[model samples]
Target chain A: MASPRPRTYAEAREVSSSNSELGWWVFMRISGLLLVFLVFGHLWTNNIVIDPATIDYDYVASRLAQPGVRIYDTFLLFFAMLHGVNGLRYSIEDYTKRPGRRFWYKILLYTVSAIIFVLGTMTLWAFTYQEMGDAVRAIGATQ
Target chain B: MYRGREGQWAFLLHRVSGVAIALFLLLHVLDISLVMFGPDGPFDAFLAFYHNWPFRIGLLMVIAGVVYHALNGLRIILMDFTTWGVRYQRQLWYGVLGLTTAIGVPVLWIVVPQIVGGI
Candidate 1:
C-alpha cells in the first residue's frame, strides 16, 4: 500500500471554491470575528463589569428575563455552536482516515449538535419571568 | 504532526483549544438551559456547584482556551484572506503566541484572586 499525497495549498483552495467547502471556510472566518466580539462582551458583562460573586441563580434569572439579554444570548448560542460544530467537522475530516468511520462520526456530530441547539432554544425562550419568580426568590433567599 | 516548529505548534494548539471550547459550550448550553426547566431547578444547584475552587480553576482553563483560540483564529482568517498573509504566516503565529501570553497573564491575575478570595 502506498501513502496518498496531500493536496497542495492552491489545489485545496480550488476544490473548496467549487463546493460548499468555500462557504464554510468563509463562514469560519466571519463567524470567528463575530464570536470574538460576542463572547468577549458576554464575559465582560458576566465577569468583569458585574462581580462574579454576585452571579447567583437570581442574577441569571433576572438577566434572562429581559428580552434584550435573551436576544443577545440567542445570537451567542447560535453562532458559537455553529462555528464550533463546523470546526470540529473539519478536524474529524482531517483525522479520520476511513470513509465509513468519517460518515458515522459526522452523523453523530450533526445529530448531537442539532439536539443541543434545539434544547438551547427551548431553554432560552420557553419560560417567562413570572413563571420563574418563585424559584428565583427561593434561590436568592437561600444564597 | 511531529515537527515542533512555531507554526506547526500554533496550528496544533489552535485545533485543541477550539475542540475544548466547543465541548465546553455544549455543556454550558445544556446546563444554562436548565433555567427553562424551572428557576430553582438543577440549574441553580449547578451554579452553586460551580462556586468551588476546582471549578474556578477549570474556568481559568476555559478562559485560557478562549484567549488562544480567538487570537489564533484571527491569525488564520488573516492568512486566508490577505495576499501576503501566507508569506508572513510564521510571523503571525509568533504574534498570536505573544498576544496570548500578554493577555492571558493579566486575565489569570484578575480572575485567580477573585476565585481564591472565595468570590
Candidate 2:
C-alpha cells in the first residue's frame, strides 16, 4: 500500500502522533536487543549446555545457589515480564481505540502486570523448594 | 474463510504453545528443586519421564510453542509500531515463520545430533 500523505498541523494531532509511536519504536528496539541476549543465553544454558537429560532438582538448586545464575535469572525474569507486558499493552492498543476502553485497558494491564511481576519475583526468589514434596511423599507411604 | 479459520487457528495455537511452555517452566523449576533435595532418585525420575514418547513430543511442542509465542508477539508489536507494518501483516506472519525457523534451526541442530546419537 502507498504511504498516506502528511497530515496538516491540526490533523497531525487528530491522527496518531509520531511522539507516542516513536516511544514504542524505542521500546521495540531496546526490548528486541535485550531479548536477543537474554533469550540466547537462556536457551544456551537451559537447553544446550545444561543437558536436560541430566537436569534434576539438585542440578537446578546448585545452579540457582550461585550468585551469578541467580543474578542472571533475575534479569531474565525482569526482562521477560517487561517485554511481555509491553506486548500486551500494544495488543490492547491495536484492538481498542475508544478512549474509555483504552483507559480501562491500561488500568487493567498495569494491575495484572504488577500482580504477575510480584508473583514471578516471589517464585524466582522466595520459592520454598522441598518444603512440601518429602512431606507429601511421607504421607503417601506406610511405615 | 482465510480470515476466520486462520485467525482462530493462530489464536488457538498461540494459547496452546504458551500454556505448553509455561507448564514446562513450572515443571522445570520443580524438577530442579527436586534435584536440590533428593539429589538422586528425583533426578532419575525426571529421566524416566523423558523416556515416554508422549512426553517427548510434548516437550518438542513446548519448544514450538516458545518459537511461535515469541515470534507472534514480535509480529504484533511490529504491526502496532511501524508505519506500514499492519498492511503487511500477512507478509510479516511469513517473516515470523522465516525468522523463527532460522533461529530455531540452531536449536534443532543441537536437538538432532542428540536424537541421532541416541538412535
Clashing residue pairs, backbone N/CA/C < 3 A, model 2:
A57-B32, A57-B34, A57-B35, A57-B36, A58-B35, A58-B36
By TM-score, the best candidate is 1
Residue pair clashes in candidate 1? none
Q: Stretches of candidate 1 above 4 Å error? A: A1-13, A51-53, A132-143
Model 2, range B31-107, lDDT digits (tens) per residue? 44344334434566766677455665567667767777778767656655577866787777777778878978887
Write candidate 2's Cα lDDT for A52-80 as tens digits: 55555555666766778778877876766
lDDT of 1 by residue, B1-119 (tens): 36667777887898899998999999888877777646546777788777788887887788788988998888877776677777788999889889989988887778878887895
Counting only residues 3 or more apart in sequence or on different chains, how many pairs clash (N, Cα, C under 3 Å) in candidate 1?
0
Interface RMSD of each: 3.3, 6.7
Model 1 captures what fraction of native contacts? 0.52
Interface RMSD of 1: 3.3
> C-alpha displacement of B85 in model 1, angstroms?
1.6
Give model 1's DockQ, 2 decimals.
0.51
Off by over 4 Å in 2: A1-37, A77-143, B1-10, B36-43, B51-54
DockQ of each: 0.51, 0.17
